[model samples]
Target: MSQTINYQAQSPTHEIESKPFDEKNQVEHVNDVSAAKELSNFKMDAMEAEKAEHNMTVLEAVKAYPWACFWAFVMSFTIIMESYDVFLIGNFLALDEFKRQFGILDHNTGKLVIAAKWQSALQMAGQLGALIGVFLAGPLTSKIGYRWATIVALIAMNATIFVMYFADSLPIFFVAQLLEGLPWGIFIANAPAYCSEIVPIKLRAPATQVLQMFWAIGSIIVGAVTYHYNPMSGKKAYRIPIALQWMFPTPLLVLMFLAPESPWWLVRKGRLEEAAKSVNRLGRKSRLNANEIVAMMRRVVENEKEGSISYLELFKMPDLRRTLIVSGVYAAQNLTGNLIANQAVYFFQQAGMSDQTAFALGLITSALQMIFVMLSWILTSYYGRRPIYIWGTAFNTVMLFALGIAASVGKSNAASQAQASFGLIVSVMFTFAAAPVGYAIIGETGSIRLRPLTTGFGRAVYYIVEIPCIFLASYMLNPTGANLGGKCGYVWGGTATVCLILAYFFLPEMKGRSYRELDILFHRRVPARQFSKTVIGPEEDE
Candidate 1:
């Protein structure tokens, strides 16, 4: 625990001259009184809370102070990297010669190959590593705190990236992947929750979207790099890009230590004075009061007492259980064909395009994905979650269905070429609609008490499902198979379309509400999705 020093406001040292008794001095005194009132208002928590109650705009708060923009920018480095990691594999795999050289060749014909089962086994191993790391997030945040937890995850992830460059065989490569996955998971789940807690409530949703925007930008940049460089061309092959991934986490490790622990987390741990000091530093205003600090502390403490702290207890309550289940269902977003479309650049090659050409196409598709993600960020607060969730999923499903139909009917050399181009466009549409909003929906589905647990569970489930889905797509699209690429695209598109339709009816709209309000939602007697439109009594609303 940080030691807290008592704060005392400093006064001017010089004594006033006798001439201060004049009318000029009287005017100065009135001005001083007005300044004090303004400072007092700035320190008042109730006034800020009231502003939120009236639905105070995020733009108004950010405009009132520009430094919030700096923090948003700094935070973007971590999230953009998260976005990059999510999609980097897509372009890298698209390199045709790269896959051939790596020994992932025609069925039973490769020299340096790990069996498909082993490749997928490696994927599962990586997912398991992530699950274990995610399980530690809350307690680690509680112990050394959020900033340090971020630093630890950063260091571990970057180190794993460096080690990855040395791997020559499947086992060594798989181990590196497993190690890398551990901390990337930590960065993904904790970074948003950390950013959300530190900023003003009004800026919370936008800040989350800002993080998402960085993610989109990062993905686009990586896609562009791999596309243009054609990472598989020379002797360097995939090694150069694989080594470059480490660069994302290296600088962030140093920056994490410079940042402060979350004030909300500190306050919940009975370190109110330290929380106040941290909050004051974050706001860059030295005059924040102890009373205002105490109010925020009290709110977190009340939540800590009432909510589940253990992983088991998180699943015990009916409402919390439903919330977890609802959140987990969106795990399908990660599992359903989106990732296969996003990550299967190599498989697309079997469909017909050359590796370099496939990556060039991927570069265009990723740009579209980024643009739509930016649009989702802007509309999330204004249009609300339910409509976006419904439409985004619905539209993505339609695109997937089209891709499936196009692939199913196409067969010869010319027809296969046409279907490949058509499938690529439809896949881009799927990513634009589904890939960006997946995190937003997860971010909104639960209260702080159950938030980390639910996120961890959902992420674990996503990866678990992803391991099989990825390899299955790879297997079906193996270069030796007849109508290779067409078959995999058809299967993935059809399955994902079904999962998305189910989600439209089940996912709740979490737009424009406080974290505290989410508890009331899960605790309600009605079904989880209905909570979006149902009005509660005044006492229940409280």
Candidate 2:
């Protein structure tokens, strides 16, 4: 004889009543149906409870996790070195001193310019090293942990800066650039993951945006330093900026030593005790429940372990879709005219602006980008990720098209060239809104067990995509090659259109979803548009 069981399903919005199941008197068919209904109701109640625990207003999360925010700000300083390096190289191209040191004299124009091959090589070498660094970050971090990996990378970057400072020849400088990229590769690949994991769900997007904001600040500083120093003759102009790179890494190295290792990473290594301690350490100011956080982390880990996904599995079926989205979004950001726009000083000089004017404009551009990135933090925190990417892409597409039109029509006139330059600046501003969000999304999208590997793979894909895109951009913008000038916008504008469509169709609303929630949503094959409306809990199985 079977006994009756009553079940209740409670949802945040409403409660569902399940009738009692009676097996002794009822037919087997009726009993079985009742039993199934009761089981489903119980699962629903568990899901609702899980979701409620994880949900918090953004303000509440911030007030709770102030220390987490402070740590994220500290970690974000890593990107300043990266942005400084990028802008220093571009601004140096317009510097007479930089040209004298590494460039060949253009007899026709009586000016010095870096040879096209050398320029491309200088750019590609760093990217190549970065590619290797990103690929290696997974194993390194998994073995030694994120904090140690960062320290090692920071030390390597300092060594490379010293090499760049003393080098008299381009070959040595090129090698230094390449070697330095390894640390940047590791830092960029892992910093977002570190930031995302430490913060509460509501603060994740804002915390990640902090990295890009510092990137802009670094760019601005480089522009100012180059503007003042580049006019002076000799290697000192370039060396001063290169030397300043040490300022960020040195202090960062000290702080990282004191920083807590990621609790999630600790959990992944079966160091639950340490992970719990870390959760408390990191979330101490937030007053978060350390035990509850650890339990939730354990559930996520157990779920992932049950799946037993291999690295190769990342390229197969469900996981492959995620990899593609993560990689594709990163790759798409490059194609949005950032490569060409980043070389703003060079492009402006090519358009006939005086060197001083070009550098000043570049400084303004960086400042504007910094402002916009801060605004993006607010917008993303309030509005969600998908809308920003959608509208930002649309805005960029139109600006690029208009800039291309402006350049083509007024290529010969200073007024038209200025218009084209202004258009590029505006386009870059729009990009800031969307590009930073991609970093957050990449960190959020990967499975916890496979995150390091998947993000590494995604970053590798990003660099690979950037190689050709950078090469093409260098050719089109460099005077020795196609010299499309602003007309190059046509190429990027078309690519942006395609990326916008892909984002609309494929990128889900990961706005406030936790990693565990995202895992269940992906495993269940929820449509991208339905992510926000869909409620998920730990009880939901793949």
Candidate 3:
């Protein structure tokens, strides 16, 4: 906590001439008279409660919010399936069994390869399907709530899992990926929002970030399974991986049925009693009062003038800024060369590593990604979201350029080895930096009333950005196509440079802020960098 600095307004026109930098306690004082006029007694109570809740140490939070932690994890568990299959698509290209079944023989290289157009198409199909699903998730989640929406999505996912399990041809597999993208879209959007809504301010970062950890875990599972099966012949190699996706939906469906609906969602829908009950369940060990927290949730929903929960609201004044920031940061995920990293098994091979080495390196990097995601939670606890993403993207940009240099130096054994090392390093760096933190930022950046829509729209933006990214990755990495191999890093490095600039300007510090404080800061039009330093103690709505 910084010194207890106060904001005394000399007049209505007098601005806050001096500001104190407080990263952990963004709203420590409530002395600006004009700002005070914005704070009702109820709002002040809400802010104070938020401050105390956010001030909880990680241990205190873990002890107090066990239910929140558990249910949020349960809600996100199914995302592992999405990541598993998404990982499989890229890694399978390197598997002889999958290639024999699905890929055409490439005469040019004497290798079996999934054609570049089809590779791009298959990836784009998922993103396109996901884009449609993302927009649909907004209204569906708003109507039925996150838990039920997830339940519905799980049912849809189960059907698609069967499609994937039995797919024998490329066309059928494409259709399966496209359809499965729907629930994956719903899961990605819903998990972060659910985690953010259920947990206290202190737990929100780690909770939302768990999505990335799950993705890494999913990748690890696929890597391990595929590596074991790589030596096997015929359909079992690819089919075993597809069959395993069935493991996700059923278990997660049971967990979802047992989980609590988001209290914030309940409050927004005017189910105060249910919201309070959900809050009580989630916060059974907390020292705070559920009723007071419900009131705060109510105030926050109303303060955003949330009547317009539709997508259009996202394009309006304050909400528009939040939407853009959320969209840009999410877009940055793709721009930072995720395709190169995510498809490292195939990518490393083309850069000259042996198939065995490629598989081993991919598995090693997936494990590292999972480990780094946990480490990122520690970084998130100590640093603000802006710095993590900005610096993370910056670090990734440098690594991308380095990878390009290694590839440009020629595919000598040492150069190929350097390329392989840098590719994995980029993946690990991205995992530590922007990857996990992006989840927390999106959940916190949007308006409370439009939280679902905001996250959905942001994800929609990602898929939109992903379409070209997938196409580029397919063409650049496919030996049958441009086959740029490691040289592809130069292209993504340029994009990452752009992403770094956007994040520095648009990303705000959402590390320690409650929904209420964030709503005020955005409404006040505080610059992105000033979010941590500018104090706006609980403020009233106009």
Candidate 4:
């Protein structure tokens, strides 16, 4: 048989390898080069697809989800209107027409002072409302959901804007303003929370900063419109700007219907499937698989479990206590004289500018502010939160100090133009540095689990400080002119200086840390000054 076999037809190795198996069962190894080539092609395809879907242009994404952009715009628009309303009053009140209409030109000094004080007083009421509203927002949202809470706040605030038209007496306007204050706090507390929570993390900074821009935009529009319309005509000329306020929020309310509830909130309520769908809508829908979605919910649920709903529990846990403190510090960031800056029209008049020049200057200042804020938004990602916080506050402190001296001496100097010009330059710089960082720090300092609570606490601090500052500023400027601004400059300058010390010593670089990681980092026992390095991943935090 061996002699007859055609041994040349097959190798002994091949024959041995195939001996145990049938023809159909014979195995073949794939070429290593070919297999690797196939895998590389597949990976490239996946990355390309991901980039296409996830890296959407802002315009394209807006078209796909108009509500997202619409809500963002509305939030921004409202702030603009607020700025316009506040600043316009200063210019109008300083005008001869406004004083004459009220029949007090002869002894207008007292009336003018009272008007400023009254406005500031109303602002104080609103600030008080803000403090209370922010403290209450967390529980209210938990009970009523963010959408409803937003609607309620908007309604209350906007309604007051409408009522301001009918306010004939100072007392009536005062009551209306106080009512208006309540909703302003609610809006401040909830809107950012809503906007920040819903937008995908990658776009968080821009979205929130855009809200700040809208506020600036509102200020600009208000300045321009009021310059032309002169809201103090005493014959309903003011209706146009005031009416615009009511008009802007109308569509915003409808847009909320399209906005899905927060997935974290949904999960907190135990609607796991709905939470997945909500998160998917915010994300590139196709990329998130069931397992990934479930994993996200599970982590959120675990965090919530670790963080109870009770306000009492907030102080009980070391992490929560740290979170509260960080958020409280964040609130003080707003206190660095930006709101007072917004009332620049009034201050300019006090600095001895004519009514028209004050309004025009207000416009110029606001436009510059808007430009700086946009720039800050870009730089925050490039430069990180710490650099902005440090440089911004430091520069602002210098400006505030310079402003105080300029305001103090300008009236007698005949170089009032130069002094006023220099002071204005410093203010512009302060606004430039503070605006973007103001919006950025709201979310950065706290854990993911503590976002709502901390945001509420921060806002509460904002309005609380805000109201008193406005009234004090009004009283100082109205009664004492240069002396008050000088003192304010000194006080605010010192405050900014304190902020600088805090920024260098305590404020951690929260620029790039993940929500989970921020949670762990803030919980460390190290002093806030050393937090930058002592935390396990200082570099990672940025």
Q: Pick the candidate with the highest lDDT.
A: 3
* Count of backbone collisions in candidate 3: 2
Model 3 per-residue lDDT tens digits across residues 332-352 = 889896777688898889889
What TM-score fits each model?
Answer: 0.80, 0.88, 0.91, 0.79
Best by TM-score: 3
Name the better of 2 and 3 by lDDT. 3
Estimate every model's Cα lDDT from 0 to 1.
0.60, 0.78, 0.85, 0.61
How high is the lDDT of residue 386 in model 4?
Answer: 71
Candidate 3, residue 334: CA error in Å?
0.3
Ranking by lDDT: 3, 2, 4, 1
TM-score rank order:
3, 2, 1, 4
Per-residue CA lDDT of model 1 for 82-198, tens digit only, reads 556556544444444344555554455453333455544554555566766777775665566667877888887767776667876666767876787778667666766666666
Of the pair 2 and 4, which is ahead by lDDT? 2
Flag regions of model 4 displaced more than 4 Å.
Answer: 1-85, 88-92, 95-97, 101-116, 287-294, 304-307, 319-331, 408-414, 480-483, 526-542
Looking at model 1, the pairs that clash are: 93-346, 94-345
Q: Which ten residues in a row have the lowest lDDT in candidate 2?
A: 1-10
**Residue range 1-542, candidate 2, lDDT tens digits:** 12322222234223322223343446778889999997566455435534644677888777777778888988888888877887787777788888887889776577788987777777776778889999888778877888999999999988888778887887887888788889988988888888888887888898988887887788789989999897698778888888888788889999999998888899888898898788777765345666567666766776763554356868765677788878987788787757765687887777667788878878887788888888888888889888887888888887777767777775467655655465556546654755787777887888877777777788888889887777787788777778777777788889889988888999898997777788778878888889999976466665
